[model samples]
Target: MSVTGLPSASGLPDLRQVTPVDEVGVNERVARFQTRSIKKESKIEALKMILSMIDLTTLEGQDTPGKVRQLCQKAIHLHDSMPGLPHVAAVCVYPTMVGVARKALGDCDINVASVATAFPSGMSSRKIKLEETRTAVAEGADEIDMVISRGAFLQGDYGFVFDEIAAVKEACGDAHLKVILETGELGTLDLVRRASVLAMHAGADFIKTSTGKIQPAATMPVTFVMLKAIKSFYFETGRMIGMKPAGGISGAKLAVHYLVMLRETLGNAWMTPEWFRFGASSLANDVLMQLQKQATGVYQSADYFSKD
Candidate 1:
C-alpha cells in the first residue's frame, strides 16, 4: 500500500495502488531506443555482451540426455575459432535434464537453469510445484524458471499468486528464482506492470517477460513497462532486481536495442549478466553469427554455427 509499490505490512503488494501503465508513452520511448545508433566499436562490444547474457535454452518435449549434452558443449565452446568469446550465462532445460546439463557443463562458470512448476502451463497443485523445485535444486540446478498461474492472477486472486511465488522461492533454497509473467496472456500493459510488482515483492530475484510459448512474446513495449516497474521497486525497497525478456528476440540488432533500453532506464549498475538475462533457444547462435561478421567484415554462412 506504500506509494512506491512495496509490500504492505501483511507482505503482499496492494494491487489497487500499483501504478497504471501508459501504453502511448511506453511505445514512444521504445521507438526512440530503436533510433539511437551505436558506433561500430560499441556495436561489437554490445554483441559480445549480448552473447554473455544469453540463457541458451532447450525446453522441448523430445529433449534427451544426448541432446542436452550437445547443447552444453555448444555453450562451453561457442565458436572456438573466436578464441575469446564468453560462454553463455546458463543452459535452461526441463527439470529432468538439469543433472545432465550440470554434469556436461563440468566446472565452467556457466549455470544450469531448469524450468519447473509444471512449466509453460503452471496448472499443477502448489505442493507438486514446490517438490519439483526442490528436486531440481537438489539435482544441481542453479536457477529455477517458474511460470506464474496467469488464470488465478487474471481472476483477481492476487493473494494466491503472491503466496505461490513465495512458497516456490522458499523451496528453491539456494537456487535463484526467475518468475515468468507470460505477458502475452496477461492482456494489457497495466496487468503486466501489476504482475511485475507482485513478483518482485513476493521474493522473485528476476521478473521475466514470457515462456517463449505464445505470440506477442517479449515485445519492446512490454519490456519497457517491466523495466520501469523495476526502477520504481528499487527506489522503494533499495533492493536490486533482475530482468529477462524471453522469446521472439533472435537477431543481434533487436537485442542491442534492449541493452540500450536497459542502460538508459536502469543505468550502468544492471549491465551485467548477473542482473539481466535472455531466456532464449537460438539467440546465442545469432549473436555468434553477428560477432563473426563484426570480426571478419563479412557474414558467415548460418551453417557455420551449430543449431543445438
Candidate 2:
C-alpha cells in the first residue's frame, strides 16, 4: 500500500517500464554542487550536522558483541576531547548484536538500528525476512534497516518487491524502516529512481542508497538521481521521504559537499537528522579529524580520534 493508501496492483508502475534518465545531465548537475564554496563558520556547522546525521555502522560478518558495544560507546561519546559534540544519530549493527548495543547504549539520546531481511543479500524467503524484521525490533532496535530483494526486482517482479517492503513495514511495528535499495547493483539511474519511488510507496520511512557492500557505492551522481526522486515524491504526495547515501563517503570535504547538495536540492526542510543519514564505519573518525583541524589549526592523525 502507498502513503496515499493506493493498492500496489492498481497504482504501482511496472519494473520493466521506465523513462530513460539523462545521464550526462545528471552528471553535470551533481558536479555543480561541489563548486559552491562554504565559509569556515558554515563549514563547521555543516560538519557537526553531518556528524549528527551519521548511522555509525558495522555490518561485518566478523562483528562481535564487544565491537557492537564499543561502537555503541563511540556513538554516545564521539571524541570527548572536543566538548559540545553531538553523538551520531544511531549505531547500526547486525540483528544478532542489537542486544549488546541496547545494553551498552542504556538510554542515551542515540538510537540502535539493526539490519534485517537477510541483509547485504535479500535472497531468503518472505517468511524468514519477516521473522528477521520482527526479531530485530523485539530485541530493542529503535530502527530497522531492511534490504530489498534485488534479484526479485531485477527478475521483473515489481509486485514481489512491493509486497516484501509492505510486509517488512508491517513487521517493523514501532521501529522506523530504512529501506536499502543498493543502487550500485540496480544497474542504472532509471532503476535507482524507480526503486526509490517503489520503496516510498510501499511504506518506507527512509530510502537508503546502498548497503555499502557493492562497489562504486553511493557516488554523487547516483545520490543526485535519488534526491531528485525524493524531491518529486514530496512535491506530489506532500509526504517527506528520508534519504541515506551509505558507503564510499569518507573525507570531511566530501561529507560537507554532500550537505551542500542535500540542502540545495531538498532545501532546509529535509536537512535534519530525521530525514538524512550516512551509513559508514570510518566516516566518524574523519569528521572528528576535520573538527580538530578546524579547532587547532593543524591536521590531526587518526590516532587522536578513537578507531571505528
Candidate 3:
C-alpha cells in the first residue's frame, strides 16, 4: 500500500477492477520473444548477464548447513578457470539456513536471500509467517522470498492474501521482499495477472513466479501474464517493480528468451539484476557451460560446472 498502484486510503487494491488477461495473446507474444534473433557475441554477453542475475537457490526439505555452505561458496567463486566471470546476484535458502548462508558468504558482495512465510506452502497462520520473516531478516538475510497464501487466493479471499503480503513486507524491515505467486496453482493466466497486481500493490519489491515446488512451474504463458500485469502497473503509476521467474528455468537458451521477454515488456530499465532475477538452483551451471562453449567452440560436459 505504501507502494505505487494502490489507493492511499485503504491499501487494498480492488480485484474486480483488474484487467482481464488474454491468454491467447500472451502465448503469441511469448513466442515472439523466443523468436527474437541474437548474434553470437550478443548471446555470449547475454549468457554472462544471466549468470550475474541468478538467485542461486536451494529450498529442499533436505537442505542442511553443509549444503547451504557449499551453495554459498559456489555463489562467490563460480569458475576460476574462466577469467573475469561475475558472481551470482544472490543465494536463496530456507530461513533457518540464513545464518549458515550469511556466514559462508561472509563479506562477499553476493546477497543472502531466504525463503520465509512457511515458504513453498504458505499454509501457516499470519502470526507465524510474520515472525518467520522477521527472524530471517534478523539472521542477516539480504532478501526475503515469501509465498502468498495460495489457498486463500484460490478461494477468492483476496483481502486475506493482500493483508498477509503487506504484513510480511513490514516484517522484512531493511531486507528486500519477493512475493511468490505460485502461478502453477493459480489455474489461469487471468488469475496470475490478478495475483501479480495484488502482490505489487501489497508492497512486494519483487514478484516471483513460483517456489519451484509445483509442477509446470514458471511456464512461459504464466510469466507472460505476470509481466503484463507489471507493465500495466508501471504505466498506471510510473513506478518500477522487479520480477523473478524462479522455477523450472535451467537451460541457457530459455534463460535468454526470458531476458528477451523482460526487456521487451518492461524495457531496458528492468534488465539489471536489481530488477530481474532467475530463481533457479541448477541454472548457474548451465549458464557457465554456455559461456565455456562460446570460449572453446565446443559443447561442454556438466562435470566442468559446479553443482548446487
Q: Of the candidates shown, which would achieve the greatest TM-score relative to the real structure?
A: 1
| Distance from true location, Cα of 140 in model 1, Å | 0.4
True-vs-predicted CA distance for residue 246, candidate 3, Å? 1.0
lDDT of 1: 0.92
The segments of candidate 2 whose C-alpha lies over 4 angstroms from its true place after superposition are 1-11, 14-19
Q: How many clashes in candidate 2? A: 0
Please list all clashing residue pairs in model 2, or write none if there are none.
Answer: none
Residue 114 local lDDT, model 2: 95
Predictions in order: lDDT: 0.92, 0.88, 0.88
Q: Model 2 scores what on Cα lDDT?
A: 0.88
User: Which stretch of 10 consecutive residues in model 1 shows the poorest summed lDDT?
Assistant: 1-10
How far out, in Å, is residue 248 in model 2?
0.9
Show model 3 residue runs off by greater than 4 Å: 1-8
lDDT tens string, model 2, 48-139?
A: 99999999999999999988888888898899989989889999999999989999999787899999999999889999999999999999
What tens digits encode model 3's per-residue C-alpha lDDT throughout 154-225? Answer: 877777788888889889999999999998888988789889998998899999999899987998888878
Model 3 poorest 10 in a row by lDDT: 1-10
Residue-wise C-alpha lDDT for candidate 1, range 100-197, written one tens digit per residue: 99999999999999999999999999999999999999999999999999998888888788889999999999999999999999999999999999
Which one wins by TM-score: 1 or 3?
1
Error of 1 at 48 (Å): 0.6
